[model samples]
Structure formats: C-alpha cells, structure tokens
Target: MLPFGRVAIIGLGLIGSSVARAVRATMPTVRLTGHDADPAVRDTALRIDLVDDVAETPGAAVIDADLVILCVPVRAIAAVGTEIAPDLPAEAVISDVGSCKAEVARSLAAALPDHAIVPAHPVAGTERSGPEAGFATLFRHRWCILTPVDGTAEPAVERVAEFWRRLGATVERMTPDHHDRVLAITSHLPHLIAYTIVGTASDLEQVTESEVIKYSAGGFRDFTRIAASDPTMWRDVFLTNREAVLEMLGRFSEDLATLQRAIRWGKGDELFDLFTRTRAVRRSIVEQGQDDAAADFGRTHD
Candidate 1:
C-alpha cells in the first residue's frame, strides 16, 4: 500500500528531485507535485519531467498534498513551513530532509503546531546538487533516520518511514536531539573537515595550481569531491547544528594532538596500533555494506 496518495516536495534540488524520481519509480500510483524557490529550477524541473507538476509557490504545492516533504536548506525549513501552513491539509503529514533535526523540528513545530512533523535525514547523497544530479537509486542500501517528536501520530510516523523504505532506504527512528548529535559526528564534522582540507590545499598550492592538480590523482581527488558539495546547504547545517558540531570538533582536536605527539616522539608502536585500529574500522564499514572497500566507492569494481 502506498503511504501517501498525494505528495508535494518543496525545494527541487538534488535531494528533492531524487525523492521525486524515487517516488515515481517505486509508487507510480501516487501523485507528485514539486516546488522550488527559483523559477529557473522550476522550468528545468518541468523540462526534465522531474515531477508531475511544478507548483508556483509552496502554498499551492501542499494545498491538497497528503504528505509534504520539505527538502530545503536547514535555515529555510522553518520559513517554508510558515509559507505552506495556511494551505497544508488539515490531516497532512509534514517532514523534512534537514541535517540538523532538533532545530528543524523546533522550527516546524512552532510553524505548524497542529501537524505531525516527522523530520528525516536520509544518510545518502553525493557531492552533487541541482535537479539533474538526482537518480532513483541514490538511497539504495542507505539509512534514513527519522526524528518524530512526542505527540506525533504513530501511524503518521510509520507512514513516513514506509515512504522512505519504498525509496530504497532502511529506516531508523530516534529522538530529534540524538539525531542531531549523531549526525554532527557522522556527517557534519566529516563534511567540515573535507571542506577545510580542500581549502587549505588550495591555499598552499596557489603558487602552483598545475602541480597540485597533477598530484590530485593520489588523494586530493577525494577531498575535492567532498568539498564540491552545495555550499548553501552545508553552511546552514553547520550554523544550525553548531552545538553538536563543536562538541565533536573538540574531541577531534584532542585526538589530532595525540596523533601529532605520537609522531613527534617517534612512538612507532603507538602510531602503528592506531593505524591498525582505524583500518579495521574502515574494513568494518565496508563489511556492513555502508561502503565498499574497492576504489571509487566500488564504482570501478565492475
């Protein structure tokens, strides 16, 4: 059974468009409408047939939607909620794809006090953006975390979870605060570090951009990929999830200092042991199917 008969998606970027594609792929019987803040994007969505219809405004998009998924940036989630509140169907379910769940949940709760807001983060995406970058298989074998607050209907929560499952995501439910803290460590901090590493590299290589490009084949390529992610989306994530990010960052700094000391003091055994342990962690991730051990994220394995 389809979880939602009529679905509307706000913000037609990679995630939003991907959701549309996945929905059409898995549940062709459901009606899909989408809206973007940009008219150009709307045009492209229509040209590419990204959704059944492109709504002119957020208000119009969710007027008859049984499920409304906010795929906007973290900072914009609340405002988008306000924009569609008047048009949101009385019994419609609300959800979002924001990285920071706690803040977004609070914002949505304040905006739509009567709705069942189920904020979710599909731990799936590439360092890509825009409507054209989406694909139906983006969430395949990935995890989707749901953070439904107290008072949200159990049936509504399950419906949203089932929706994600149909899009090829394994679903897990957690409190909004815990979801934010966990994502800060697992997703936010890693992206922050990737951006920093790429920036630092570019700064140091300013005098010789050519050679930096030459050596990029070794390791810089991956950092560049991560750093290539959409700027606006990542910016909001860090700002809204600052508390959890900073907490994880402090621990990271302490660990970095320890590693530096080990290297400086020529503690070969300590360095070797740490490397071995970390290597096992990577192997375990591959074993669990979170990633593949092959190069190019198993893309080239074929």
Candidate 2:
C-alpha cells in the first residue's frame, strides 16, 4: 500500500475513478477525496463509493492532499492545475494520467505550485469513458511511465512510482521528450490510422456497406474498436502531441504507400518479406512481455 496521507483525484472520469477505486482497495488507510467539473460525475462517484469524500471544487479537493492526481483530458489539465495550485499544500506531489507527457508536464509545471509535479501515463484503458466505466483493476499489470521534469523532487517521483506499483503496475521513469516520441508511434499513430480507416469505410456508398460489415473480421473490426475510443480524449491527445504525431505519420504514410504498391503489382515476395519482418517485431514484444501471446501480434491489449 502507498504511504500517502491524503490523496485527491480531480476529474471523475474513467481513469480518475479507476485510480480512486484502486487506491481505496489497496490503501484503505489513506484519505481519498474526488471532484469533477461535471457535478453529475461527482454525484455518481459518491453514489458508487468510489471516493471517501466529494469536493465542490478542485481547490477544495486538493487542499492538504499529499498527492493530487489529475485525470482530465490533456487540454483541460493546465486549467485544472491552475485552479488547484493555490490550494496545494507545500511538499505535495502532483501528477497526471495524461497520454501526451511533454506538453502536459510543461503546462502543469507552469500553472501549478512549485511542488513536486510528477507527470505519468498509465498505458491501460478501455474504449469506454466516464465514472461508470472505471474498475479497480484497470491498471493491473499495466505500464505506468513517470516523466518528471527538471526541478522535480526525487522523493516525490519515488512516492508516485510506489503508488502506481501498489496498484499492480510496473513503473518506469522516462524523459518527457522520449515518452512523447515513443507514444506518438506506438499509440497515437495507430489510433489515428484506425479513425481514418473507419471514417473512410463509413463514407462508402450503400452498395458495398452490407458486405463491409459482414466481412469486417478480415481486419476492419479491430480498427472499429480503436475508432470507438473517447473522442474528446483522442482529440486532446493529437492536439497536444502534434509535432511527434505528425513526424511519425509522415513515415507511416510512406511505408503504407510502399505496401499499397506491392499489393497493386501482385508482388507476393515483397508482401511476404514485409509481413515476416513485422511478425518478428511482434515476437520481440511478446518476448519482452509488453503484451501477451494471446493478444495477436501485440495489436490488441488483452
């Protein structure tokens, strides 16, 4: 269990609520309070016993909190940090669950108090959002990357790392720039590709639509699942990590074009070679235990 005295989570969405539930389940002695911009979300969290107390505002929730975790969309994180900054107690450890680390870390450090701001990203979530979609084990066995910026206290980072470790996650420390670039390829690009393919399919005429749905198992179905992730969350991710994502997308498009040409020319050898190389990448991921063998070439999580 974490040794935190008081922990407050802002934004009672899926990630926020999940953190609250995990903390309560694992560290029952710690005081937990929660608040969300949406009053309905706060009420729902209270009703579900996800938090020990519900605060009327971010300031009220973070008051005297040894750990303050922001679980809001990336775009809203800075504003929320500012709102809670004045109420933050000295030596408090502030952190976030934002996907894009560099921008979030920079913004929060600028807006929040000069306490310990340890930016983290938990690489686990479902397509669902909102308080009702959260679960205590959502972060179990997941990778939680902590990107503590310059001037961040070592003890504060360790405390946040321990907190995630207690929640059944493997914690790793990374630089914000490295985290942004890696996730741009591993996560952001994939999500963007999924959304594009699904949007293109939806724009097709009524003629082949029925067949598209019927034969979706050919690979389109997986894209549909990624496309269904929370729109607001994804929108914020892209906007916040624009540079890294664009750089990755340029390379991805070139590779995709090469594959398209190989298919058009009926070059079986080229296709086979490309597939074999990609398969090795999958094997490497499984060997590293980043994904389970049952997840199909590390394309899906669980």
Candidate 3:
C-alpha cells in the first residue's frame, strides 16, 4: 500500500519543491498539494506545474492531505504548524525538514497537540534555493532522520519512514536531543565555520576585495559555496539549535587553539598526527558512499 495517498508540502522552496518532484517521480498516482508564504514562489510553482494543486494558504493545502511536510525555516515551523492545524485531517501524519529536532518537536507538539507529529531531517541539499532549483533525485542515497516524540504511534512513524524510503533515502530514528547533538557536530558546526572563514576573508584589510576574489584557491572556493546557503535558514538553524551548536563550537575552539599552539611552537609531529587522523575521516566518508573520492571532488578542470 502507498504510505500516503495525498501529500501536502508547505513552503515551495528548494526542499519543498524537491519533495513534490520526488513524489511525482516515485509515486505517480499520489496526489500533491503545495503552498508557500511568498506569492511569487506560489506563482513560480504553478508555472513549473510543480504540484497537482498549489493552494493559496497553508491550511488549504493540508485540508485533504494524508501527510503534510513543512519545509520552512526552523523558527517558522511552529507558526506554520499552528496555521495548518485546523485544516489537517484527523489521521494525517505531520513531518518537517528542519535540521533542529528538539525545538521543532516542541514547537510542533505545542502547535498541534492532537496530531501525530514525526519530525524529519533529510540530510541532503545544495547551496541553492527557490522552486526551480529542486530536482527529483536530490534525496537519492541520502539519510533521512526521523525524531518522533516518545508517545507517537508506531504506525505513524513507520509511515513517515516508508515515505522517505520510497524517495530513495535511508531512514534512521533517533531521539530529538540526540539528533540535535549529532547534527550540531556533523552539519551545523561545519556551516558555522564556513561562514566565519568566508566572512573573515572578505573583511581582511590587507587584501583588496578584487584581489581576494582573484586569488581564491580551492579551499576558499568551497567555503564560499557553503557560506552561500540561505541566510534565513542558517540563521534559524543556529538559533534553534544554539545549545548543541554552542557545545560543539566550544570543543572546536579548544581543538583549534591546540593546533595554533602546535604551529607556533614548530610541533611538526603533533600537526602531522592530527592531519593523518582527519584524512582518515575523509577517506571513511568516501568509503561509506557519503562523498565522492574523484580528483578535486569530481570537478572538471577543463
């Protein structure tokens, strides 16, 4: 049986549009409804025929949906939940794509007290935004983490997991708190570092802006790509997951200080050992199929 017959997506940005496209590709018969806060986005969604129907409001989109997925920023999850609560079907399973789970779970529970909320984070995306930036294969080989509250019904959680599985994602379940902590180190901290590095490069008085751009190396280019991610989304992610992010940031700061001391004192062995261990981590990620080992990260030098 299909996990969901009618799916509604709130927020027609990259993730939302990608879900609509993935559903259409994998489950042709399933109905799709989508809505976005921006009228321009809604118009773009219609122009692209992104869904079976583009509703004018959040509530309208979920009125007949079997599953509703919120793809907005983390800070906006609660307001969207409250907006759609009145129209959600009694048995509809609610899920979201927000990175922070603990605050999102709490917000969702508070907004829709009687609903079966299954918060999810699909660990896939690019430094792109808007409806036209989405592709049907975005979730292929990606991990989708589901963090349902303690008392959520098993069937509802399974349905959400099955939904992600059908979209070509491997599903894993974890507690909201644990999910936040793990993602803090794996995802959030990396983005934070990227933004800081890119910002620092831009603010250097020793180099002219044009000079910085002209001499950009591979590492700085990659950091700029990470920093180019949606500001609103990252802002909310940092704020919503502040505790875990801060904890991970503190650990990172201490490690960075150690590296600084090693470089200053000519501790070549210490630096070499740390670099070797970290290089193994990159290799492991590639071995697990999480990244490409191709030369220059699969970039075409031509």
Measured by lDDT, the strongest candidate is 3
Tens-place lDDT digits, model 3, residues 1-302: 99999999999888999999999999999999999999999999999999999999999999999999999999999999988888889989999999999999998999988999999999999999999999999999999999998789999999999999999999999999999999999999999999998889889899877887887774688888889999999999999999999999999999999999999999999999999999999999999999987967898978
Query: Which of candidates 1 and 3 reaches a greater lDDT?
Result: 3
Please state every model's RMSD to the true fold in angstroms.
1.5, 2.6, 0.7
Count of backbone clashes for each model? 0, 0, 0
Please, what are the lDDT tens digits per residue for candidate 1 over residues 77-158? 9899998999999999999888899999899999999999899999999988999999999999999999997899899999
Q: What C-alpha lDDT does candidate 2 achieve relative to the native structure? A: 0.90
Give lDDT: candidate 3, residue 275: 92
> What's the true lDDT of residue 242 in model 3?
98
lDDT for each candidate structure: 0.92, 0.90, 0.94
**Superposed model 2: Cα runs more than 4 Å off:** 206-208, 295-302
Query: Among these predicted structures, which one has the highest TM-score?
Result: 3
Q: Candidate 1: misplaced stretches above 4 Å?
A: 205-207, 299-302
Candidate 1 minimal-lDDT segment of 10 residues: 293-302
- The C-alpha stretches of model 3 lying farther than 4 A from their native spots are none
**Residue 160 displacement in candidate 3 (angstroms):** 0.6
